[model samples]
Target: MARLVRLVRRYFILGSGLHLVACGGGDSTEPPPPVTVTITPASATVNAGETQSFTATVTHATNPAVTWSATGGTITGAGATITFAAPLEGGPYQVTARSVADPARSATATVTVRAIAVTVSPAAVTIGAGGTQEFTATVSNSTSASVTWSATGGTIAGTGTTITYTAPATGGSYTVRAASTVDPSKSGSASATVTPVAVVVAPASRAAFRGEPVSVSATVTGAAVTGVNWTASCGTIAGAGTTVTWTAPQSPGNCTVTARSVLDPAVASVSMMTVRPAFLVTSLGDANDGVCSWTHCSLREALTAANADPGTDTISLVVPAPVGAAVANTIVLTTSLPAITTPVHIVGPGADVLAIDADATAGSPRRIFEFDGAFAGSLAGLTLTGG
Candidate 1:
């Protein structure tokens, strides 16, 4: 009985074969027909820990017995059905089926076992800004034992398990990957990154009166760790800090301020500012109820504008006495005033008429006039007393 279950259903495959059978029985004894065995699927590739079914067809012989064997790996089957199990590693192999009746006749198919996985070593890496590192890939279950390499944001060299990498000059993230040479689809990957080391300065622009102090700041990042070296093109830097003081030149002009990393001279930042002659007070605003440029006639506003100006600005007091109410001559300050940083004269109507009363509620009066070391200004005709 010829038991044919089904055609090949993906177990693995074998090459096709051609055979002719001639059976003639007229004399009393009859000879057996020639037996041809063929395994479907001439060639195939499969991953490890996987299975593919191979079907065999018996030609010429009725109730034929066929045996399946492999050059590598394992197979399981009965009758004309055989399952070829791929090895854990990747390699080229062969599968064959032979007719038991005609031991000399056989059919063979090619098999290539594929790697289950390929893992790139050093799963994660970090590199300094403009640095370099090496990478490697390890392939699992591959008899071929070979891999191709690649990467992002940098140059990679060499092949197989080991390779060289040159990091990007700037700070950022990057990765490396390895693919199995035998099985292109089977691959693994790794990662690397570049970090930045430098410093930055701020207050991109500013203005100060000649002989006045200019305020600026600096920030350090990445590698420039120790501190900053400050420099001024047209003035003298008085001190060192994230925020620093710079005295302007006696002649009105422009200046460039810079902060360089103590660690790396190549990394630095700069700011620009101008110096002017003098700034005269514009509005003798009594708007001291709140803080603003307009509406609130607070001296805070007057002085803030004066300090913010780039020149030697003056703050002259001239009160517009409200018609109905007594002229509010006393400028009572509840909070401490901002430090004066420019060269400007502070003049008033009279020492008695225009008084800067530092405290009305506090037991002790606060200082009313705070000066920057570089401020060159005159105070007259104004009575000022503060704690």
Candidate 2:
């Protein structure tokens, strides 16, 4: 038992010496792994005031978010997806996305900024003279909404984004333009085609005596106007064009001349005319035949004779009868006479004894006294039947 206790004391002393050697060096924790960053869509091209997306990927990263920045643009929203907006002035720029976990670890991408493009609405249009058209300018990748407007023809109204284009009074093709205020160098243009307009005419007033010659004149405006059509309400317009010779109707009163535009059929003008009166006839004949006399004759013969005379005359009437006898002075006829075209006044013997009986020509319905539409005259002291 004494030998076993000596051996146990020697083993305990050896274990203490080995433990002191192992505890002399070496740390319990190791340093973190090095991080590296990478970017997606390594390079891109975009217009001024345009937005583009960028992504950042980090290996061995400790933080979940990435800090976004640009050397010449605006940046928004960080992390893997970053939004970068190009500057208003176009140029090359560098966009960087850095790892939030390690400031030293970051990635960059190249961005090319291009000029903005402008477009115009209603690129082309057609209108008649004195018409108007409206145009608009739309700018892509622009920072402002306003635009300046101008035109090569007619008038213009308004200044910003929208503008009105008024066509010239004369017809032709015209040009209109809109310039972008955001980018002065960029502009949009449009074309306007104007068509012909309608025309109008005017005529003058006139007055003349019967059988006298008269004329009318008129002028026209608007579309290309040549000659005009001529017409008369109570006379004859004899000429072919704008100026016409007017012959007063034998039987006349008030009249008018209408001038119509030849180039534009819808346009017309009118002038007033007046004709004076002449001649008065008192007929013994009941017939419309131009016969005139002082004694017992049919009313038709009196008119025929009066119309043949040079100057206006009145027919004094006396019914033919047996001398010194109370025989009836009734006159009858059997044939139709020409119309009473001239003015006249028929005076009979008396209303009681001067009955121009239609008994001789009453075999059928007939006109005892008929006046032409132009005749303005009177019939006194006569009883006419079957007229």
Candidate 3:
């Protein structure tokens, strides 16, 4: 009986101890949630060599820190916020924010890098009508570095960076544009001003007697200032403007008249004027005098002056009528007239109104007038007898 009681008491004590341990000895703390990371602005775009910012939101982590990294380009900063710099090369790039507590818990953002820019040389220029100008284009941030050219008011030739622009026949403002072949939207432009100038002179050719005044006019086109400057090679200009009077020189020769544009000195037009010699006969007697005055010029004296002059000469005869009952104005030749060495044309009032009598009492009768070798002359409106 004593042994049985001891066994029961030991069994009861062990059972009570097990029950107490099961009721109060177990741990009561709960485990933390999983670590998670998310990024702000999951996607973005930036230019080459440009910058972009990113921020990360960390959850269920003891240490709320992030490490920034990129597949391409450079990344800076720490913690949740980071700055990303795009590389010079273009295309898609990846940016990642990894959790410091757990590297496996990371967030990624896509960044698109664009690298196209265009520029044109000779930003501004001026060209004449039908003139040509060359332009060059420079492309940056692009591997191709090629550009297409276009013109608003001219024709473009060639392709790529270098091209020629030919101005239209008309004058006006124009524009030249260059666009990147990689990115057509990225373009540069240049300005062009076309100015066309021309000049024309009236009476392209003319014939004038020495000391005579000739009228000349000029026409200017395609210029802001439609005025011209007149210049003569062998004559004097009377006035200015589109119309001017030019006086032939005292000697017979070829003269050139030039009309230059006021806007452009290089543009001009020319006209030619021929000057010839002329003489007048005012006396009724045909005497060979040493001098030939303008007021009292005999036929012999006029012929002597005409022969002395160079080039083709002209003689005008005007003899006064007798006092009363005169059949016609008669010129009695006491001496023969001078031989015509050069080309000449003698013109009188009328054949019936004037008569040349070659009968000379002192000297033997001779031809009325002699012509030298290779001399070409004409006589009209006169009566000749007693040759």
Candidate 4:
């Protein structure tokens, strides 16, 4: 029994020695110390004065406090967590985290913040006076940047990517620019233009007649026209938007009219018209009366005698206006044996009676006779009125 007790005591001592050796108290093999720490995102990038955040870890560490710092910036952290602030000037920066127990074991992380670029579409737009224009802006290299767009020399409205601006009453060039809300230095710019609206005298001509209704057509260029007002000496017309119909003055003269755009009263044009009578004829010839006679030995003979002596008449020869025989005033009646001075006259509708005044002298007997015969009728219509 005593032998058994000694053996048990020896066994107990041996077991204690083995435990100490396994624990490296008296063994050649030894355990290693805590491993170095590694941090993800080895580097960090941020806008000037901005902050970045990260977590730090290490091997063989339990709730171990850590120290944090920035190589080229400012850092703030209590233990396994850290926040690194970017420098005033933008550039690459490193953040480090070390275990308080093993200062040699440290970790690093990197963060990147991009720069911003902005551009405007339709670099320049021209709008007529009193017009409006819309603008669109494109942003690049920035995700959370807000922009403030402005037109220094014009009227501006709206916000963000799409904006609108109105032209002034006058016309000129306008400069516009934009800046990022986060970084004003990273900005872009563009320009716009406003031009004067030109007025045109449509139809070009104004010739018209007085008191007549004239139609005038007008077109306003360089801008859109909504309505037109027309004025003339003849007075105003109704519904004269771009076309005017007015009556000219009643008097014979010239009239002028002006057409003005309703949207822009300053733009206008003019036209003119004129008005004037016409001349007409009604009579042109005369009639005279005298006498000729036909009488002789026969109505036929007397008629022949009177025609043969067309230059001699009894009334002309006997008149005192010539007094005496006055150069004979005679013409040969026929080539008979003795020429006779006979004044012949015929009267009656049917077979006419022929009268003859034969020889006549103050001292000689005058012979007056009539030839009444049916043959005289043949010369009845011989109406010799005067010579």
Index of the highest-lDDT prediction: 3
Better-scoring candidate (lDDT), 1 or 4: 1
lDDT of 1 by residue, 1-387 (tens): 123333352222322221111222334576766778888887888876456677777788755788888888899877777888887666888888888878788888888776568887788888764455677777666556688777777778777688877765556778788887766788888878677656667788877655566678888766424478999898889888777988777555789999987655677889887865433232443344433322233567667767766677666565654444333466767678888888767777667556676773466547788888887988887777544
**lDDT tens digits by residue: candidate 2, 1-387:** 998998888887888777765675454457878888888899999888878998888889767577888899898885699789898777889998887888888889999998676778899988766667788888776767677887888788887778888787666788888777767777888898877554333335655545456766766544333567777787777767656687776554788878776644555677777664432223333554332222234566666654554345455465554344343455565665556767666666666646665553335666666776776767777666544
List RMSD in Å for every model shown: 20.0, 15.3, 9.5, 27.6
TM-score of each: 0.37, 0.38, 0.53, 0.46
**Full-model lDDT, candidate 2:** 0.69
lDDT of candidate 3 over 155-258, digit per residue (tens) = 99998789998877567899999987766877898898988777889899998765667899998776646788999999899999999998887677899999
Candidate 2 Cα misplacement greater than 4 A, ranges: 1-21, 35-71, 74-85, 89-94, 97-104, 108-117, 128-130, 140-143, 168-173, 194-387
Reference-based TM-score, model 3: 0.53
lDDT of 3 at 97: 92
Clashes in predicted model 1: 22
The 10 consecutive residues of candidate 4 with the worst lDDT sum are: 277-286
How far in Å is the alpha carbon of 94 misplaced in model 3? Answer: 4.3
lDDT measured at residue 9 in model 2 versus the true structure, 0 to 100: 84
Model 4 has an lDDT value of 0.55
Instruction: Report backbone clashes per prediction.
Output: 22, 23, 0, 20
Sort the candidates on TM-score, descending order: 3, 4, 2, 1
What lDDT is reached at residue 27 by model 2?
Answer: 46
- The all-Cα superposition gives candidate 4 an RMSD in Å to the true structure of 27.6
